[model samples]
Target: MKRKLLKFLNRMVLSIVIVVAAIALIVVLFVQFSPQFGGKASKEAIESYKNSKNYKDGVFKNTKDVKLDMSLKDMGKALMGFFKSQPNTKPEHDLPSTKIDSLNIANYKGDTRLVWFGHSTFLLQTQGKTILIDPMLSSVPAPHPTLGSKRFSQELPITIEQLPKIDAVLISHDHYDHLDYESIKALKDKVGHFYMPLGVGAHLLEWKVDKNKITELDWWEETTFNDFKFVCTPAQHFSGRGLSDRAKTLWSSWVIQSKNDNIFFSGDSGYADHFKTIGEKYGPFDFAMIECGQYNEMWPDIHMFPEETVQAGLDVNAKKVMPIHWGAFKLAMHTWTDPVERFIKASKKEKINVIVPKIGDLIYINSLEENEGYKFWFEGLD
Candidate 1:
């Protein structure tokens, strides 16, 4: 009997080993072949980034020491919270959205009009140029469609097919939510140029974006497209799409300046002195899209809360601000409307102008005053 038991135990152990090895092989193959995981920086791309002050020890660094990992206790809390059925993490039903006409974009002459496409994605029309910022338009933000939750709003303001040809797409970092593979694949042929921080062009190159069309920049680096000067500025954020690639690519905020107007796009950031510095260098912005959601006390140094979003606007000397990084995904524990509700409450205290547009509503930058009195669009929704 003892001999029989020993033989059975050995077989069980071997079976377990085989199962584990198969799982490991599957993961390796997926990462290798999946287009959604995106491309990494080639040796040449890494070599070109060697001179950047922020690129050190073979990875990008933030200006200040920021926490990129969570503590064990916080991790436990996050894991437990994930399965605890927290209420209101997402909207109860499909939210409202407006659709735009393709004809309007083809014949566009605008004073820097902006449209918020749910989360951080925006369609900016300025000086006859249509640019997309952090265009992660796919339903699920995960590497695979089955790996993530669908966005709260089931519809987009405009489908990718309906979009007029794009002049450029500006990326701030390589986080899956901000940089999506499917979105880029759909847009690569339609876009003229792609601007991003250092080391991000490799992903585009792998996705078949022409190398000539990709321009990568380090912090404070500036490039021009048509009537605008695109400056890659600093942000207090870490980046990666996978477990191992953290900080391999740089993250940044952006300054878009035309001869007549200036705008700021805070890709993703924690509150830091960089905002004030950006304001000093490219202050007095006509408008700013400030990140204001997916924030938590667990990882406080990476994303900003609502009050901090308001202050960042003031720090950047923005005349009018639109709170973004919310209105779509349930990335944190906060309620669906928490970011905007808190942002408006805080903005009133500072008397900072807030531009709250329904998803897809047009924002004319030349006259922001006309954009006010937007109804609290999320109040009635569950």
Candidate 2:
């Protein structure tokens, strides 16, 4: 009887081991072989990262140590919080948007004209060049449709296919919400150059973008397109598209310097000293587009509160500030309008200039009109 029992126990253990091994193999195959998760950092890329000040021990690190409130208790609270949805998390009616007239926008010879397509997507035409920044125009921000937040707006101002010949596409990071797969695939043929932070070009390469069109930069690295100089400045954030590979790529804010205008795009950053450092290095910007949405107190070090967004704009010495990263997706627990409302109040207190344009509204950088300031477009929506 004892021998028979031992044989049964060994069989059970072997079966369990086989099952676990199969599951592990499946996950590895999915992460390594799947094109949706993007490509891993190549050996050449790894060697290049070895020389970067931010990369160490096979991962990228922020200048300041950031500890998220990920304690077991905090995570439990966060999980519970997801079950309780806030009122007005999404707009009651379809959000308003103006369809893009590409020829008129492209041909208009004037100061920089910016058209916001909700969230961080912006089309900026300046110096006779058209640039798209963080162009995540997909309906959902995720690897799969079943897995992520759906966009608040039903239709985009312009489809990627309808876009004019893009001079460059500036990618902030590889987050699914920012560096979307479908958008990149549609834009590959239309774009002249792809500018992004280090380790991000791997994704473009995997997507079959022309290697010659891709320019990857480390922090403070500057590259020029015609007369426009783009400097990859630091940001307080993290990156990952899968369970593994966290922080394998770098995240950054960008400072675009033109002959007469300086524009700063604070790409999904938290409140940190990097804001002050960037301000000191590239201050008195004519316009600053800062992130001001999808924030939670639990992850304070990753995303900034609306108040901090305004403060960051001030820190960067922005002559005029406009908040992005909201109005597209309900990625947080707060009301959909909370970010802009809070940001407007803070800007008022700090005596900072802010442009609150509606989605798809064209903004002329050289001219600041009263109609552009504090348009409570989201008001009265249930």
Candidate 3:
């Protein structure tokens, strides 16, 4: 009996050692190849970023100035809190079978049609022009395919090859999720122009996107493409895909103004006074697509909470608001359904107009009240 016990113990120890060694090897391999591993921001851009007054004081005066509340212990406690909570009671989403070919761009009329292609990716079509925003078509939101957060659903409503002639590509930042390598590679030879925040053109240049096609804008700067004006507005957030390069690139929200209407795309932002300032500069937006999920108290200054999202929409003077940044990935500790539910409640209280569309549903900003048949996508979840 003693000899049998000794043999079992030896086998268990060997198994443990093998597992540890395999994990260590995988980590080393990943670190060596992943773009997020150690890509450096251009020294010139970094210096310019540091010298900027926006970088010196930060975006949000109240919260951005405060130190982070997160630590290893706090993370551990938050993980424990998640496990202690009850299992998800929300019913699974039985999304309809999406037919990409059936999605006709012409059906949207002269008004802008905004299609949520999961997470931050969106298909924006207006006045016969189609634009893709943060076109991340990859299944995972990491530098490597096997590493990071995977998509909750299949590919978006339409594949890159099937997309209409892209007039322009708008990028808010250069995070792997927002500016995917594979997606950019596919779009490189296809799209005509790319608009991005200042210093973010480095990543695109590295990816071989035409330098002439890329237009980088600083805060409050505006550029015209044909008849549309794209303005880079302030957002309360930092940028960096890796540890060493945080805040090296500027982050921004975009205000797109066409001949007849104005649309606001709150790329990804925390709550801040910039919203009011942006409203004053570009007031009464016809439609506003605001970030409304993947938030937590530990990083409150970098992401807006649910209630704050509504306030942001109001502050931006949006005629109609659509909550985004949720329904794609579980990036925070909150229950997956919390963002939409909270947003609905808050918007109702604030008397704000909101439209909650499904993953592939296209919403026409001008016809929001007319097209009241938008399916309650979060019905079962709530």
Best by lDDT: 1
Per-residue error for 291 in candidate 2, Å, reads 1.0
lDDT of each: 0.90, 0.89, 0.77
- Which is the winner by TM-score between candidate 1 and candidate 3? 1
Full ranking by lDDT:
1, 2, 3
For lDDT, candidate 1 versus 3, the one ahead is: 1
lDDT of 2 by residue, 1-382 (tens): 9999999999999999999999999878877776778877789889989999999999999999987438998888777765676578888778988887768766866788899999999999998889999989899888778677688888888877778799899999999889998999999999999999999999999999999999999999999899999999999999989887899999999999999889999998889989888999988899999999999888899999999998999899999999989999877788889999999998888888899888888899889864367779788866
Residue range 1-382, candidate 1, lDDT tens digits: 9999999999999999999999999988988888876788888878888899998889999998888889899999977766678888888998898888988887898677988888899999988889999999999889987777688888898888888899999999998889999899999999999999998987888899899999999999998898899999999999887767889999999999998889999999999999999999999999999999999999899999999999999999999999999988877888889999999999998998898888888888777673383579888898
User: Where does model 1 exceed 4 Å of error?
Assistant: 1-13, 370-374
Superior by TM-score: candidate 1 or candidate 2:
1
Best candidate (score: TM-score): 1
Error of 3 at 222 (Å): 1.1
Instruction: Residues 152-182, candidate 3: write the lDDT tens digits.
Output: 6765787877775678999998777688888
